[model samples]
Target chain A: MSVAGLYNYWIVILLMMTGFYVVISSGNLVKKIIGLNLFQASVFILYISMGKVADGGAPILREGITHYSNPLPHVLILTAIVVGVATTALGLALVVRIREAYGSVEEDDIHRQDESL
Target chain B: MIGTQLPALQVVVPLLAAPLCLALHRPFATWALTLTASALSMLVSILLLGQVLAQGVIDYAFGGWAAPFGIAYRVDLANAYVLLIVTTISTVVTIFARRSVASEVEAHNQGLFYTAWLLCLTGLLGITITGDAFNLFVFLEISSLSSYVLIAMGTERKALTAAYQYLIMGTIGATFILIGIGLLYMLTGTLNMLDMAHRLITVADSRTARTGFAFLTVGLGLKIALFPLHLWLPNAYAHAPSAVSAFLAATATKVAVYVLLRFVFSVFGVDFALGTMPLALGLAVLGTIAVLSASTVAIFQHNLKRMLAYSSVAQVGYLALGVSLATPAGLTATLLHLFNHALMKGTLFLALGCIAWRLGSVRLGDLKGLGYRMPWTMGVFVLGGLSLIGLPLTAGFISKWYLVLAALERGWWPVILVIIAGSLLAVIYIWRVIETAYLSKTNKTAGAGEAPLSMLLPAWLLAIANLYFGMHTGLSAGIATQAAAALFGIQP
Candidate 1:
């Protein structure tokens, strides 16, 4: 398999679609957060893949090497990863608060209880 | 001195205020600091707007780094207008929150509330000002995380659940947006928006660019609650505390709409977004559906806050409708409605906050006869409601007028008909509240007196401004027209 083949992007897209499916289909709120994390992780992978240079080692500035990986995409992915982590943490916190208040993590059950009220 | 630092100060003032609020710890002291910080940021935003108007555009590279290499803060006519709206709303809402927060949020949590409010303000302003695409994502998370915390601080037990729902949906939206940014960077090898715009023009017809554009549009569409993707909004708005409701209603979605505009016109260019794809027609259909369906749903909502939430969805439809027109007049209409809706809805939500403070519930049954007791508060609500319905002398009317004109300009009379029909539906929902408050003789609201002066002042100020701006459309309309024309690279 050649390194420049499109397999890496295919895997990333698969992971992203799976994560999206879980987020949309799952009834459990915690599961949805997990799915969101996976979805973001897939995006990070995509960014890292785009930054890859064929036959090039690392992105460090070397004296002899004529080509190096794109550093801009790496930096952007790092910031995006931080944002993803922040969103995950906030989502979990909200989930804990929701469980405390509603006494359930299932979306359907919470809606049922709210409707009853 | 301040003129040079205006761009940085617009964000730093609120960012620094969060820590000061935490250090103070006392509720009153935190409130005072937050208000002062918001007012200061508003002052800086005003100065920045003035500079942008006079000097064409202001670009400040962070840490003195040049553009396309380091992050830059770009202030053009479009973003300066948004900055003014965000900062001005924050200033008003912060003052209102001082009184409104005491009754809704717990005492110990008040400090944290102010901190989160400040952070949210900073994030919103930062998102509007930043020129780097990745920086926009970072600031978006700052705002989203803080907004989740603020929404959870509501007194109602359901607020936590609402916040959780918002968190999940917001995370999905953010992830989509990050992916879009990643894709764009993959193709262009840069994160700067202007640089990306320049690069995108060269490869405008590539499959990767088209896919990237689709992701960005859908992601922002979800954030701005464009029609079917707006499920998270009504619940979040309905269960959150009054102050949170007012702030988010007025600013958050407006900022998201601005982001959509930035990408559609500035980043991707109008030719690709509005011409290459059927996006304009699709958006026009969705906007019309959202207007009719959301308004119909709002008419049946028993809770005043929930009704207003659905109404907000309908108002978003109007903005989307303007964008769908894909003409300079259409963009101007969208920008105008963005400002007008912020003022009208902010006032409406603030008036509801006053009612919630006194009556402890915003359900229509509980609000019967409220007009008799809290005459001033109810008067503000009525005025806001009239504006929501697009009465001739309110801010809403001006936006609708321009939207219809844009539609008619393109010979799309069906869109004009939909606009009229949507406003009629709006009249129905607004009438529901009016009838419940005035004509009904229920005894539930017998003791509901007027709200405190602190609350009424902010609410009435926005309400009066609605009428004032509606009658005199010089400032907002002029700025919006110029901004919209600039967006299309045309002179007005």
Candidate 2:
């Protein structure tokens, strides 16, 4: 494939690595979740990009449309999006509880407190 | 009529019951519902196994839509065997949970606790049964999400962080899986496992397929708590409510192993996974390292739960060892250990739950003379520990026997030595607890007699099953032999 044709995949690689790096590098609990979200969003983009045909219309039969993008991936990813939202919500809720329990959301602070306990 | 619907009802019964648990809002009512749902699925799994044995594989499409398009729940001997193990553990755990949950969890959260338990059961059972690759991912999340809720309900303030840690790791693992599936879908344009397998043959050497395989392995390795990726487990297990720890320890990672077996053999084919790849060698080497390192780590831990959690990782190494051999006899060892490990660990963890019930802690230092005071609980603890150490005539010995024989058949003497060393390490850790409880002196648990007969009954039931199934290997080993042979397309 040409460079232009591979543009979307390059974006996917960049986004995935960026998100992954932040997840491992950040000490703040909320930032990790955000990093996770960004990581997932890259895959969502990958799926959406792969499903697209260069000149295809939406996957609905029309009078003159000859090409159509795949709809299955979009539908599959919708379920994933819901799952992703649920994960973020639960993650944030846990963060709230962690803050209430430990008085801090930084990973190091929580560990230090636990050590003293 | 219901016989044909067994596959659907296997998951639907618990999935539907989960919501009612939240609506009921009373602890007793929800516990009853949880028990009922677990028991019903246990029955369905048994019937499914019987049907699979008598007939052939039972493939049921959801809503009457056929496969390669609509989702399918395919039950062969392997899937049925895993279902049987999972549902049975969930049922026993539910029985043990009544009193455990009452004392450990807050009364207000008890209903939601059972709700999450039922949903977790749904997710586990669904993962075992689904033939659609994407549907398996959905069920994986269902279980993962509920387990996070279940773990967070731990009384310790640290439970929050454990759950948080597991959430981050588990989600990354799941997303890796999703990406792997997405890559495979791009190549095959099919989500049905069997169809993907059939098409994967043509593109088995493609770089994309290999990358997909890597993602799947790493993601699953994390879920299975393979040695290096096992960071979340000890804290998660150690901090979880005893019942939650017991339940997850018995079912979750075992189900993950089942998925790995399914994908490697059924979907990827032995040729693709082992022939082209150095998977067998890699697994064998890593399994060796895991067994030695995790067992050594387990030996030094003071907390019983944390020790056992690390031991669980080592036990997973044994399973990986068995799978690495990649022969029919070898897989029999894997499957047999998979079932027997559940029985033994379920007994051990449940017994620990009882001890924790009285003393409110699982520190090895806490209970010195409790073996005399709580004879039955401690007696069973010894029994489960014996099995954990692979004592002769115990269930662990049976599987380890087969694992060694499988290795000997390959003339892999070093692997056999590692297996023995792993068992010896188990003895040291287990003996440490036994010596502390029986050999040391303390009146700490003076008034704490035995746990209620209600809870002891279930723990004893699992412990006794160790002896029963250990002596009689027809049910566990028989099905495993057939499944393993079937995987290699060999005559049994």
Candidate 3:
């Protein structure tokens, strides 16, 4: 119930909203991809945050630290990060093709061209 | 070890085959690999379904770690059923793809097309079979990324734009889903769905759990293309290579709906989802809108593929409406439709692919008087159309019958009226194509011919399946009832 315990989650939410807002409001295709990257990165932070143990060390298999960070979330987030990167690459490639085809990366311009067609 | 290995093989077989398909670098060899991989996956899924059916639920812990601590693959009736749908569609589509891809895609890229097709198959099956929420997100991306490539492989220039639009929208949806999974993990500290479900029940009244639910619903709703979220669907389906459209329209959104169902019924618990929240009303309202709006829109489309795509949205509404009913009967209807619609739509799209292959376009005008030239193909189209319109003796009618009964059981007469109205709209659009193909005068300038036997076989196989299942309700309805009962936490 303490304010201190909820700080990490609040930051995660803030980051998520910022990315979502950019994706929704931006007209530029590159900016949308960046927003998507930020959005996925924020989720990565959330997953990592959940893995934290009180006074825990990194999730290494060494002998010293008694409290190990949750390895499951770390593993899950690794897969997610891979997916995020793949999506980003695909999005950027699509943007490049769009630029070539439509001569603009702006959403409105693309739509206008499509309408004219 | 073999028991432990089954889950990994279910996904890995298809995954490995995809790259091998590319390595083969010949259309014939690639097709063989793709078909073998899909067929093997289908066999595995059937076996897994039988195992799960007998043993209640089988949870395979990954890397030798237990639940709440490790990733797991949980196979229950629900996922097993979805796995069956994904693999079955992949198998049929692969057979259908042989001739269709030969005609639609470049000969050199046929290998690449098969590679992507196998990868897409792997992703869909993985999404259905995986128990870990994050793994679901990963598989979702895999399927989605390949789908964009597959859609872009169409011969039309418009296919690139359609793929681009779908890429943008699909990424947004995946991001939302990832965020939802992140929120759930933050709140419950678990990635395993069963573990998360147990934890969620403890924190059911918390704001975090409620927020997570909202994110998950919206994210999955986007994937399912629920009404307003369906803007990207029509273009993608219309422009994608005909085989890709058939496979995707039949399988992709259905799997998304399965994910939504899993999260709602299994992870969130029925009490919180159905009793405490307005989810039922929301689903019912949006579903009704999708049915009426999309069907109405479908009637106006000149392109047969685009028309069926819109109709797919309308059919999706019926599935959602079934879920909203929140009864065993209702869920049964939803599951039945999920299977039946896949058969019907898969057939419809395959028929369109045949038309596209022979006529070079599926425009209603282009189809004029072609029924005589391609009797078998047109016959398949008409049969699929009959199913789409929910006529009495087709697979579509069985689901609609059950859905209507479910609505009546809930005293939702208005929903019954909506279903009937939607079916009527379906008839109009289907009749448009029928009239164009049969009644209109033929043009001497347009040379029409029948599709190759490879295409006709898969199309007719599904068309006949439409009739076969319609008559013999025991298999589809029986399994669906058991699956739905299991979903509702009821024992058969």
Count of steric clashes across candidates, in order: 0, 0, 0
Ranking by lDDT: 2, 1, 3
Per-model DockQ against the true two-chain complex = 0.81, 0.91, 0.59
**Which runs in model 2 stand beyond 4 Å of their true positions?**
none
Error of 2 at A68 (Å): 0.8
Give the chain A TM-score for each candidate.
0.92, 0.96, 0.93
lDDT against the true structure, each candidate? 0.90, 0.93, 0.89
Ranking of all predicted structures according to TM-score, beginning with the best and ending with the worst: 2, 1, 3
Of the two candidates 1 and 3, the one with more favorable DockQ, higher being better, is 1
Interface RMSD of 1: 1.3
> What C-alpha lDDT, on a 0 to 100 scale, does residue A106 get in candidate 3?
93
Greater-TM-score candidate between 1 and 3: 1
lDDT string, candidate 3, B242-319, tens digits: 999999999999999999999989999888997787899999999999999999999999888999999999998999
TM-score of 1: 0.98
Candidate 2 CAPRI category: high
Model 3 misplaced stretches (Cα beyond 4 Å): A1-11, A61-65, B1-5
Q: Judging by DockQ against the true structure, name the best candidate.
A: 2
Off by over 4 Å in 1: A1-4, A62-64, B444-446
Question: Alpha-carbon error at B450 in model 3, in Å?
Answer: 0.4
- fnat, candidate 2? 0.81
